[model samples]
Target: MQPSRPLDVVYDPLYTTSTSHNKYEGHKRRVVPNKRPISIKNNSGLVSGPERHKYFCRPVLPHLQAETPEVLYASAHDAANIMSISEDLSASTRSIGMQTMYRDSHAQTDPFSPEYVLPEGAVAPEIESLTNLRYRKGLPVTQAEIRMIEHNRKKKALKKVLPPMSDEASLNLRKRMMEAQEIMDLKFRENEIDEAHARRIEALQESLAEREKQSQAINSERMRRLEKTLMLEKEDANRRNQHDRIKELRKLANKRQRIQTILNQGSKKRDLIEEYADYASPVYAPQMRNGNLVRKSPVPEVQFKDHQLMTLDSIRELEKNLPPQIRTSPKNQFLKRAPLMKKSRDQMTMETHLLNVESAINKQHVQGEEKLPSSPYKGQYRAILQRPSTPNYAPQIAEAGSEVNALRLLQRLIRGRAVQNMMYEGKDRRAELIAELRESEEARRFLSSSFQVPAEETEITKSAFSHVEGEVVSELLDVLQKELIRNKEIAKVYDFAQKAAEDRHQREIEEGARRQLEDLARDRHDQIYCFVTDIHRSTANDYIDSIFEDAVEDLTYRDSVVQSIIMTKVIDPILNILEEENSEDTIVKDLVSSFLFPWVQKHHTQDQALLEKRKYTSAIQALLAKVSQSMRI
Candidate 1:
């Protein structure tokens, strides 16, 4: 026919439907019979139900089949099995037959498919043919090949065409193209290099800016803190200076107060002295004058009375001339001698001078007048004068001696006035001094209360200076001496205290030095030594060890010696001198017994080797025996 047509293939969905229904023929739906004739129910003579149903059905319903879950599940399973079988068959066949069939279908003419026609209302452009080009024999006419051919044909058509520019212009155009490409490449390289450099520059700038900001902040903070510190320091310094000035003012005020007090005391003393001088001047002058006027020579000249001597001799001759019996007899001799012994020479002279006294006494005696005694030397003479003596004359003489003793006592009273005056002077001076001191103390107290020291440490500083001025050792010695003399028990207590303090001090020093040496040994491995040399050395190492031990022993001995010196020379002597009750001999014995003897015993006991080497044990025993004997004494 028009060119042998290929066989047409048709698909019949009705045949598939009929065959599917036959397979499920027993499960088909049955029609339901109408049980009653169709009738309209009249409501107000209108067909409302059918009319409303027709109105509701006016809108189109979607023509989609509703699928049950079982149908959808079974259909999905069947499709999955079919896809798996198709995939397996396609994999085995490599889909070559399918691809051939698809190509064939794509080439069929159908208006609905893209393979049927070109696009609507679109036309292909016209192409001009080349006349002077020779055809290539074996070139394939693919689209690309066709494009190449068209390009060659265009070149042949333009074979007679001249260049639009001269040779120079063309060369310039080629050069320009190369130059543009070079420029683009250079720009790209520059962009890449500058990108890294730019990033580095940006980072450095940012770092610099950050550092500057931090530096400025630190500097500002430091300056602010420094300013605050400076202000505080300046304020503190000003406060200290003010305190110093105040302290100086207070001290000056105190000094002025002390000076004023001293001046007032002086003025008061002077006034008192002037007042006392009024009573003292006149009385002292007269007493001095009377004393000078009545002054007598301490020694008296010796003189003898001639008349009294002659009378005494004449009396003795008269006594010798008396009868031998009366002279020998005790009663007559006593009677003769009593008047002679009783009457003094002065009384005889007074009797001789005043002869009337003897004459009157004799006349009064004759007339029973009081009989006065005659002198013993004048008794014989008195017998010649025929004078009588009174019996009461002996009592009068005893009374006269008593009166003389009273006068002597009066003289002693006069001598005691000098001692009273001395006592008065001492008491007066002490009173005035005490008054002045009291006034000074009052002034000092007022000043101290009124003006305080500026510094808290100012009082301590002043006390320290005062302490430097006051020698502590001298004060301690004075106190010790006073206590020893005043109270023996207190003195013993103080002595014990002093000994305890000294022992404590020595122990502290020893311990401190020991600690220091231990530390030094730990730190530097060194030792300190004190030594006494031997005359000869033994083996070297043994000698060295012996020397070290000897050195330590010597040091111990030296320490003992130092302790002895401190106790005996410094401490014991101080105690002994101040001990008022203990006699010198007793103190010496006590010291030797209590201290020295014990010390010797300890020394001998401690140094057995030395005692043996020196053969000193016997001597020590002897010395100890002597010491024991001395202590007993």
Candidate 2:
């Protein structure tokens, strides 16, 4: 008989040994049955003293009983049949049968056989032979049964199994695998090259499109510049023409003045002499002598006809006689007595006065006394020529006529001189007046001509160009400013977005690390029930609280910074719009309010906290305040 191998056992007790021993001792002890005695004699094979006492003391069996041999045989056969049926059932189920079959097949092959060995002295043949034997045995099995057997065999074979290939063969196989991998890598590199070429082509097309747009913009700008230059040239030409016309008119005026001066100098002296001569000459001559009187006449007495003389005398006498009565009257006195009486009285008086004066005065007074004596004789001679008393009227009439003629001539000369002087003065004055009139007329003509190009039309044209240029300048300024602001905002937004993305990435990393720590803690708790208690009690709660607080503070700070940025970027622009509105800057205000505000609102949604902040509303309120203040200004 073979001795059985010793069994190995290990036991663990949680509590201390003393505590276990104390508990065991306190329990009531249970009694076990004593062993039954067996009788054997040492050499004769008889019962011994201790064995005889045990056998005699034991009861003996009574008389014989008959047994059925056939019954026993039948029982044995039935037991054998039952065992066979069980075997058949296990085989039909397939998994148990396949496992047994694979074991039997592998048992037939020697593990150390040459067929199971490899050339390099490694043991691939053993694994191969075992796998082959298992495969053959399992071929008739169902798919499920074969899978179960294969799984069991792989699990068993994995333990203490030799390497599948010899060392040299494995190196060659690895090299082939590496070559295949290199081929796949080369194919992938070719695909990447094609993709890069496509990208380059697309970039070039985009650049070409941009260049075309730039060329069009340059052309438009050049055309505008050319138009402006042409307009300036035209204006200069018109001004030059106006100046030339004015110069021509001045030259004509100088020529007219020179002609007028020549006419004045030639006419002056001749006119003065003619006026003096006309005054000096008389219409008739008067006769005059120097100082002496001479008598030149003989009296040829023309005798009147006798009848006429007598009749004259008679008539005188008759008239005297008839008018003696009437003579005394005022009307008839002169006709009646004048002739005869005057002659007689004159004769008497002459004789008496002559004698008396001659006597009274002596000769010197009458020195020519001799002449008095000759007076009688002189009667026969020519009666003392008594000069007929010439009347003084001729002198008076002559003086009056000369005075009148002189006055008339003087008046004529004065009038002529006045007329000539007036003509000379008027000629110069008229020239000037005409020149003034011509200038005024020309100015009027120019003004009238200018009206053909109405001021409103010219002004409208000018204003249209000015408005277009101003709009261009304003638009350019606006676009440039907007672009600058947009660029600045984009930079800020990019920075903010980058910061946010960074923060998110950092948070994800922290969360992943925290989860890993939590998993480690949980694993430690599962493995050793109390391992995590110190960490849980002392560090975890405080760390979580600090992290939450810090996160909130950082978010609040970021929000504040974003709000300030928005105020600088967006609020100020809005305030400008509002200010413009208050000043009645309609064009500017309309552009900003209508075009810019909506643009800003759309831009704010990207920031997490900024989106939640009521920044737009606050900015609008601030702008309104600014507008109100500006109105007061």
Best by TM-score: 1
Show the colliding residue pairs in model 2.
323-327, 362-366, 363-366, 363-367, 364-367
Q: Which regions of candidate 1 deviate over 4 angstroms?
A: 1-175, 191-199, 268-633
lDDT of 1 by residue, 1-633 (tens): 552432111122233343434543333322234354468443685447634544432233454433222222222235687798788887846633222322454652212211112233544222212211222432223453465455545544443343445589876775676576567557656865676556755675577679989999999999999999999999899779856865765575566556445444433223433533454432223245433332332223546676753777888978887998877756433334554543485467446545744554464455344333343232222111111232244567777997889999998998799789998999897997889899999989977874665665678878897887788867888999987788988778899999998678656655765687689887553322211122233356687999999999999999999999899889997887768767889878887799788888888888987768667778888899999999999
Instruction: Point to the candidate with the largest lDDT.
Output: 2
Q: What total of clashing residue pairs does each candidate reach?
A: 7, 5
Q: 255, model 1: CA deviation in Å?
A: 1.1
Q: Write the per-residue lDDT of candidate 2 for residues 140-183, one digit (tens) a residue.
A: 45664554556546544543343345688866776676575567
Once model 2 is optimally superposed onto the true structure by TM-score, how far is the C-alpha of residue 121 displaced, in angstroms? 34
> Relative to the unseen true structure, what is the Cα RMSD of model 1?
59.0
Could you give me the TM-score of model 2 versus the true structure?
0.16
State the displacement of the C-alpha of residue 257, model 2, in Å, after optimal TM-score superposition. 6.1
TM-score of each: 0.17, 0.16
